[model samples]
Target: MGRGRQKAKHTKIARELKYDTYNVNYSALEKELGHPGDDQYVDKWADQYADDDEELETA
Candidate 1:
């Protein structure tokens, strides 16, 4: 059985290139990087992950 929705795939490059949040379009990024359809595509990229621990600390 499938989860109904697709599980986003992240590329090593994207992971390294941290964004402000997890709401980015990895497919577009991949195209920009000249590696279209290379099995690393995310649907979101938000900035919340930037200061992960800091945000938690403040909270």
Candidate 2:
């Protein structure tokens, strides 16, 4: 194919992809990831390192 034609085809495909809307299935995603729908997820390690981080910041 010619360079101009190839470039035009790429641009058309890119425009179509850019304008496409994706429908996200959150319930299915959560089930696939084994994550409960509860939003109270907490990081245990963050709490353990909180004091050490504050000490470094003061120094």
Choose the strongest candidate by TM-score: 2
lDDT of each: 0.61, 0.84
Worst 10 residues of 2 by lDDT: 35-44
- For lDDT, the strongest prediction is 2
Clashing pairs in 2: none
My TM-score estimates for the predictions, one after another, are 0.22, 0.47
lDDT of 2 at 30: 79
The stretch of ten residues in a row with the least summed lDDT in candidate 1 is 1-10
Q: Which stretches of candidate 2 lie over 4 Å from their true place?
A: 35-59
How large is the C-alpha RMSD of every model relative to the true structure? 19.9, 5.8
lDDT of 1: 0.61
